[model samples]
Target: MLKKAILLIVLLNGLSPIWGQKYELKSIIFEGNNEISTSRLKGVTLSKESPMWFLQFLNSFSGLGAEAIYFDSSKILFDLAALEEYYRNYGYFEARFSYRYELDTSNFNANLIYTIIEGERSRFRSTFFYGLEGIPDQTYASLIQDYFNASNDWYNQATLEQNINNTINILLNSGYLNARFDSTIIFRDTSANSADLNIYISKGNRITVDTVIINKKGEGASLVNEELLRKITGIEQGSYYNQEEVKRSQIRLFRTGLFNSVIIIPEQNEVSANNVNLNLDGNIGYMHELSPEIIVNNQQSAFNIGLGANFIKKNFFGEARKLTLSTSFGIQDIFNVDFDNLIKRFSFRDTTLLGYVDARATIEQPFLFGKPIFGTWENYATIRKQKDYNITYYGSKITFEFELPKYTFVNFLSTYYNIEQTKEVYRTNNDSLASKLVSTIGVDLGKSTT
Candidate 1:
């Protein structure tokens, strides 16, 4: 090993000479930053990066992934422009920036330092509303007064978009089916460095669904149940337009993982003149994937290797159920198989488990008993062998991966475990021991949830 290390060192040193070179970045330092931390600014800069300690040390041997990086002048200039733009967007228009560097000749590495000066933040001076003459008094009251929690802090662009969506929702639920927003208008106050915002609301004619259709696309694009789809939609011929219900129903449909795309389109009903028709059109594709896997793990005290294949079906039997099947052949501590030195020939043929074979299969139904509770029923079965110990493990489990209180999910499983042992050494019952079976069944409301 010593001779090999010397040879490796000679080969590395003899190839090239790297004594004096251009300055490369070793560290970056920031000063005068108060509101934002130095790390946040570094996140957006594409030029400089801080290397991890262990990776930097490893780079000394052979540089590889996630190793040290050097400084580039072009990237530094790009980062400067990006930082100024970031400050301007965050209401720091008068921000100032400068940088300097310190170099070390031993390794041709340098430390870069940046200085920041953040100025006063801009605020929204005034807000106004228009185009609400046709809306009801209560609707209008809900719109301008309590629709937003606009504090006296710095202006945020996200707040404006949220309020606009809120206005559209309110108008839709209040029988204004075709409500929309006009272009936002802003006026800046040059003297005080503040701005004014105006949002115009348009409430169009109220309408109801004249007809509803579920159009599926792609091969094998069948729903789990037509009745289930209709029930989830929760829209009827004479039902009033409710944007909240539409949004909620769409989310429930997407959670099933059955469709690749879902789109809700509403069109005017010219014949009826007052009602509109909606189409819930989506596409579901046939899915079948199989892949081979080889895994080897070597640790301080143990080694294990396995060869396996995984098979998956996204929609099982066209019912939106998912099935996963996997099988493996594993060997653990292959060099330490039980043996008798008297007979040098291997004893693997005498039921002395030199290796083990394992297989597992599981299937999951996302919606339990066809309900919108965001729950699933999963069944799993697996078998393993401990050849050297003269024992085998066989087990099957039924699990309920379901939503708990207020939209949280938990996994609860019940398993039946069986063990088989070779009777050459001792005599014992072949019967297996498992979780106690409860044959009788009854509904327990407190223990069960939708």
Candidate 2:
């Protein structure tokens, strides 16, 4: 028993060094870590205590299956520096990290070390072009200089591709339809800390118009007016066919209101410069007029009632301006109800009153400003009451109206008045005559549809 007890004491003494040498990573607090957090670093630990913990930690480290020691950090400071570098490789150039460390000999405690460092950033400093012989040099000068000075700008693969596409479009619109640009863009660091770009352009061929054909399809096939067709074509056989002008022609024909639908197509021919065959497909429709209207008014409120009919032409000078001519007749009664009341209150209501009824015939010829202005006018006269108790009055006014800018209208009016007076209402009378001239101005707040 004494021998066994001595052996047991020796064994316990031997095991004391392994158990007492504690290595407890109590906390792995980090600092200077802008992109990564403390929790994430703590999660990377292989051990949290000592003795038996170290054995499990060794096993965990072995299970990492790393081909090299690139991820291992025995010291907290080393781990933070490694983590920062890892973030930099992923384009987090401004990333940093640090740690704190603590040692307690009596309790066997472990603390972390803090570290900080900046990361690597990959950005664009400038963009340029080369091997563009035919294009004007000034075209790219401004764009390249601007992109280079943008320091915070990153390298974008799509932007480079779109730039090439836009360059090709410019060439195509300038009569170089066969132009092409290289797919590859070369990026070089001309300066140690800056990136420079160079793009190559290929100007293939300069083409001109070889021939142009204006074809109209549909019926009244025989009734299709040649004069109108010629005006609509707007392109000659020997002239260069402008793509933009061809599109405008399509819109123009649609606005004419003569066709239900119009389409202009440019077909390429097997010529040196491409020949354009314009195929116009449309349905021709005849012009017609419909006029039916209703109006309501209160005469005491100076209101008028009117109804009319007219004919209209849709396109004037191919600019979608409407031309209209119409004849309208209306009855207007103007009176002041307040005036009658006031006269009654003043004891003048018994005085004899004179009222008039006016009838007129009008002819309107609406036109654009640059055209001649001419219209017809006439008037009729009738008497309702007399003012001098024995006097009866009649009058007529004739006027010619002209239009300017579709908003303002002007007219010249001439009036003739005849009055007859007698001692009694039923007696024969003596007459007097008066004539006057007046100019009138009118504004059309609502545009005339017809």
Best by TM-score: 1
List, in order, the clash count of every candidate structure: 0, 10
- The prediction achieving the highest lDDT against the true structure is 1
Tens digits of per-residue lDDT for model 1 on 331-394?
Answer: 6654564546425654433333334576767666555565544433333333333432333444
What lDDT does each candidate get?
0.63, 0.48
lDDT of 2 at 71: 19
lDDT of each residue in 308-398, candidate 2, tens digit only = 5555544434323334444444444323223555455632122322233333333332222433232223333433333333322333333
Instruction: Mark the 10 consecutive residues where model 2 has the least summed lDDT.
Output: 64-73
TM-score, each model?
0.48, 0.37
User: How does candidate 1 score on lDDT?
Assistant: 0.63
Q: What lDDT score goes with residue 79 in model 1? A: 77
Which pairs of residues have clashing backbones in candidate 1? none
* Regions of model 2 farther than 4 Å from truth: 1-169, 178-204, 218-233, 236-241, 289-310, 314-323, 326-450
